[model samples]
Target: MILNGCAIVFDDEKYFSLSGDNVQCDQRYYITNPLTTQFHVKYKKKKEFSPKLLVLMTMSSKDVFDIYVHKGEQ
Candidate 1:
């Protein structure tokens, strides 16, 4: 099953290029964690997990309909 936190960024005309603020152009989403007291029992002792960004522009059809999740210059 897919997690709730999965997100994507469309490489639309406005967001095709990685310019200006990268965060502002990319779309962000988070997975929903089931609420349960048992789930957070080891919150303080457990490791934190960060969300991943997946790009779907290349996988999509059409030149003008591509969406990208670009990682700015290192």
Candidate 2:
């Protein structure tokens, strides 16, 4: 697996990164802006695979969401 990049932001607060391990892993989310109390995290994962296998996974909670997937040559 490879970490592409991350640009997560909520309530005027901003976060950036280029490393993450398995989208299904645990992550922490918080509200950066005081004025905004509600926020959402949207994650999208795209897997690169050979021409033989493909997989996908998506999970969400009351305040967090994650999307993962694997694909093959079209």
- Tell me the TM-score of each prediction against the true structure: 0.18, 0.18
* Candidate 1 accuracy as TM-score: 0.18
Candidate 1 positional error at 15, Å: 18
Q: What is the lDDT of candidate 2?
A: 0.39
Model 2, 1-74: lDDT tens digits are 24346444322222222234334545645556746553334443535531333333333322334433344343
Q: Please give the RMSD to the true structure for each candidate, in Å.
A: 18.0, 22.5
Report the lDDT tens digits of candidate 1 across residue range 1-74: 36455544334222233332236543443446536335434243422332334455433232345455654342
CA lDDT of every candidate:
0.40, 0.39
Model 1 residue runs over 4 Å out of place are 1-48, 59-64, 68-74
